[model samples]
Target: LRELKTKIACTIGPSSGDRGTISELINAGCRIFRINFSHGNLELWKEWTDNLRQVSSSLGVDCVLIADLRGRSIRFASPIDAKTYSAGQTFYIVRHDGREGEVPSVDSPEFFEAVSENDVLVSDDGRGLMRVLKRETDKIMVQALSKLTVRRGKSLVIRNKEIPIPNYLSHCVDQILDAVRLGTDYLGLSFVTSPRDILAVREFLDKNGSDIGLIAKIETISAVANVEEIAKVSDAVLVARGDLGMHFPLEEVPRLQERIVGTVTAIGKPVIVATQLLGSMISESVPSRSEIVDVMNCVVDGVDVLMLTGETAIGSYPVETVNWLRRIIETYEGDVRTRREISQDQLVDRFALGVVELAEALNAKIGIYTKRGNTARRISRFKPRTQVFAASNDPKTICRLMMLWGVEPIHVDSKEYDRGLEELEQKLKEQNLVKRGDTLILTYGLLDKPIHTIRIVQLIS
Candidate 1:
């Protein structure tokens, strides 16, 4: 796809676990595959990981696999579960004794003693909430202010809301290490709410001798409040809008996403916008128009990764969604023609620097002609304001250049027009690398290509 733009990450699950589907996802423009620890057992995860390895090897693609830890998930203990309720819904979730019928004793010493006053018990993935009101030897009263209806095996969140912790996340530190041990390139820690939590995870990874990258999921008030600190400590951060919106007010989610993204961008680390972008596509083959707008907003706000959660995990149209997203990102980014300068510093190569200076003197927009990706990196290091478009002969080179900042890449046939300057500009314009009335900076010329000049800059209109 010559018009491909934006970095895409798709979650790999039962629907996309096979080699064929995984490869399809890759072809559709998924650079990362995420394995969620919460859904399946370790054996299942191993099988999925094997499939990912096989696909990446055959395709020679930069596929980053992220292992998601299944952390602490507290749930209810029965059928007809009651979840978030009004101010006072006296509900009882009795522990099963294998009895056939009848509501078990709420007065049972065993069940009642497990609860205490002031315990913030949230059920059904934080949809149901309650606070302990009164405590006795065998029964405790609670005030239910959240809607909650739960069943056996469903999650219940009983946490100290006033505690100085981020959230009652899954206790999966060891599980995280398991994925790290599997040669997964990235570690996604769920429910990360503070800088300390991220630090603790990284320290654990380092202690285990794992070099995998860490991504902190921001989904709580504490995490959003302390986002500045978390961004500094995290290798990357995920603006997990799903639980985040549930945890806080809905009106505040958008602003929080923007705030976190902008802060992380300042630190020069990747920030991912995850969950529910194409949520409807889990069953449908395409995403909603609003979803497309959501993704475009992410790109405009400078998010490094646009993520797919359930859409690629259990979704029937996982591969289709990936392809759709790839097309949308490419289409939207192509319309953004304003030049964004990234830097003004000089590079290690004096010749490249001289060329850049000449391009500026010519008032041209600098385009680093590179096939190997080195020239792009060197130019980005200088952080010039000129929008950097790295034209390459290799598609992989273009994809890999994404790791650097502000370096957009375009792939072309190097041999077709290496001999003439006019052909190069024509090709550039045809590829939408530069538009009419736009200034251009050209970096081309290799001894092997029969040119000794260190390339020069020229204005294009």
Candidate 2:
């Protein structure tokens, strides 16, 4: 299989959680596996993580695990029979307090307190819309604006409204420690409204002495409004278009996606564009023409990663879904140009840009020796056109580098930078990844230092 610059992330579920299926997925070019906490227990998550690790080791591929925490997103408290509502029909949204009532309800008291009369509630990505008519002590009466069905555990959001993040996120500490115990490299924070949400989690992680990176999900209007601040605090940002459609008009989703992508990329952080990239392929064997175009557009937009949610989690053709996505990414990746120039006043940022400019001018591939992956990330922010290889001795750093654009992570055992680069070059040569007469721009530096060294080397027969 050919290496792809734009990485693919697959959500693990019953359809693709087995060792054999995971091996197939790794061979099919999935480097990041997402374990969603909303659906599975710790036992199941451990099983999935074990299978992924074993399969990846057997296949000699390094993969990263993401613990997708179920943040403050509101959902039905319990299973309820699906009920269809007609336009202008009255429905009661009751708080789940063991009360016997034939109404859709949520278990969160904050949600009930935050909602008011005339507020609009949407579910299933705006498929169902309800306007709040009146508020009682424990329930709210709403009028249906469209004909739709209400199902159990369906996510509902107050349209265009931002709910406050509680002083403490319920169960977040336990979830963070659970993820650390499971050896996850990144935490995917859902429904993030501002930088404070990320900082609060970061503070908790630091207190516990965990260095797991954070990827803030930009799905709320408030999140989009404060994206710059959020991106500054986050290690990465995710453009969650599915729930974003619920918080904003459908027509504005595409524009919002572009804006979020641009903002996150400019901040020198990895940005992911997710949700419904290939929605049709969940059941069908082939992707729709529009879906293919959408994938290509993401590549053109300079997105670091394109993620698959339902397309791989519950979809019948998980392996083929990854195969098609890989093909789409590889097909358009060569034509991608840097969308914009990111200007930074830091010496490291200017040095990275100069290295990229030199590599481009000489038509040479770039190689870096990094201990904490900061140099690799700085170079990645420039959107280098040539192939870039980042070698590190730290396993965590290598896994985290998998999320960056155009970066191929290599793991070496050497503690010294010089030896690490030698090992990296040998591996590249043994794998035929680089050939004789190919040019390489080798570079490395200390993150704390104001100076870096660059070298031009040509492979010899």
Winning candidate number (lDDT): 2
TM-score of each: 0.67, 0.95
Model 2 regions lying over 4 Å from their true place: 80-89, 98-102, 147-149
lDDT agreement of model 2 with the native: 0.87
- Give per-residue CA lDDT, model 2, range 1-461, as digits (tens): 77788889999998899998899999889999898887778999999999998999988888989998878788876446778899999979888887544578788887888899999999877778899999987889999999968766578899867767576456476787789999898999988878888999998888889899999999888889999999999998999888998999989999999888888887789999888999898899999999999999999788899999888888999999999999899899888768446456677778889999999999999988999888898898878889999999898889879999999988888888778788888888887878999998888887577668888989996
Q: Backbone collision count in every prediction? A: 20, 0
What digit string (tens of lDDT, one per residue) describes model 1 on residues 1-461?
A: 55244478888887889999998888877777788876667788899999988898899765667887654433333454333346567754454555433332231233354567777766543456777787666445666776555554454444534223333333676687678668777778776666767777777777878656678788766777888888777666888786665566557778989888777665556678888888789889878989889877876665667888788888899988988888777766644322233445422344555655666566666665665555555454334445666666655555546644456655566643354334556677776767767767666545255442444444345
Clashing residue pairs, backbone N/CA/C < 3 A, model 2 = none
Model 2's TM-score against the true structure: 0.95
Worst ten in a row by lDDT for model 2: 336-345
lDDT of 1: 0.65
Model 1 TM? 0.67
Misplaced by over 4 Å in model 1 are: 72-170, 334-461
